[model samples]
Target: MRPKLVLFGDSITEASFSDGGWGASLAHLFARKADVILRGYSGYNTRWAVKILDKAMAGIGGDAESPAAVTVFFGANDASLPDQRCGFQHVPLEEYRENLRSIHAYFKKKWPSAAVIFIAPPPIDEEARIKYPSGQAERTNEAAGKFAKACIAVAKELSTPVIDTWSKMQEIPNWRKSTLSDGLHFTTLGNKVLFYQVVNILIDLGLSEEKLPADLPYFYEVDPNDPSKTFG
Candidate 1:
């Protein structure tokens, strides 16, 4: 039987581009060998992801023998909005780490045999600041990076694998050029690049095969007519 892999995250993972988001692209890439499930929601944070998992498993009869792998990405929205209301804006770094730990623990207990890969949110381009005009986007980018590093530290404690998408994205020269026009999401090409990185990590960990296609295309240049061509 084919293995089951779930991609969970926010809008970026939800990628509503014409060609579908990175999760859908990943599903296509592994279509021949595995069953990929996209469970992303727009504007979802780690807190919401935890709740979603609870809802999925409530009353369902499943066990480790039929376990499903999960890839989780959050921290963007958590750091994006200010905390005057929930006071999460003032949430300490230690608390953030605790949140991650709780999330990992919850999934591990529920699906003991499943592989859980933590995915860090990608870096935000400077252009995104204009959309909010509150400078929260820049803060979100910084906080997301910190959150990624914190997740890495947590993974070491739990012995789980991480994709490190945040750092990989920083290495891309003029990454802003590859983003969607909105400057908050990735273009079709951006998602393709992300897929390549993710697949590589999965293969290195023996969770997936290394036999990926070589001629995968990405949107390198911005095309105003194509909605999929825009990425932040």
Candidate 2:
């Protein structure tokens, strides 16, 4: 069976299977080499995610091969202001850090061989958030940056790879429109940037499309004189 790459995160991850999304990009690139599994939960914070992790992991099959890599992408919601409308989703910065550590520990215990990657949340566009009020707590780039830093800190402590989308996106000019869609989510270009970031690290972890072997032989490998030679 092909090895798997699982995406574990929140709304950003949940929508990653949509057209021009990062998840879709990975799935397309790894077509026959590996299975890219999506386990995204919209409007979820680390607290809620930690609670459901075991149940989510159960679907991978206890006896089956462990995933080659897993990405923990959250923090966007956790960065919500405690006093804002979306305050209910807010998880304290310290708790967020601890939760990330716990998540990394759980994965390592279950599959030591798997590469665990953490993705810091992207920067928020305050003006956009105001224009398109989605009932989510009013978030600011500064607040999100804090959570992103905490995420990086946890990844460093755990000695794992991390993608700091929050910082990277801002490097681009006019990032508010170039990268973010609703001030919180990703635009197509944003997805491309994220996809490239993920693919680069995955390549480093030996999980790239070029590194993994395809499951079956090519059509050219089959011989007309003996079809069984290829089938068998």
lDDT of 1 by residue, 1-232 (tens): 5667766677776663337567777677676666676666887766666667777545433673444577777766666545423234333567656777787887788777777888776766655554343434434567667777877787787888887777776676677667443555777666766788777777876766445332333445557687464553
lDDT digits (tens) for residues 169-201 of candidate 2: 998789999999989999999999999999999
| Count of clashes, each model | 9, 1
Q: What is model 2's C-alpha RMSD?
A: 2.3
Worst 10 residues of 1 by lDDT: 83-92
Q: Please, what is the TM-score per model? A: 0.76, 0.93
The segments of candidate 1 whose C-alpha lies over 4 angstroms from its true place after superposition are: 16-20, 57-61, 81-92, 132-140, 210-232
Model 2 lDDT on a 0 to 1 scale? 0.92
Best by lDDT: 2
* Candidate no. 1 TM-score: 0.76
Q: For model 1, what is the error of residue 171's alpha carbon versus the real structure, in angstroms, after optimal superposition?
A: 1.2
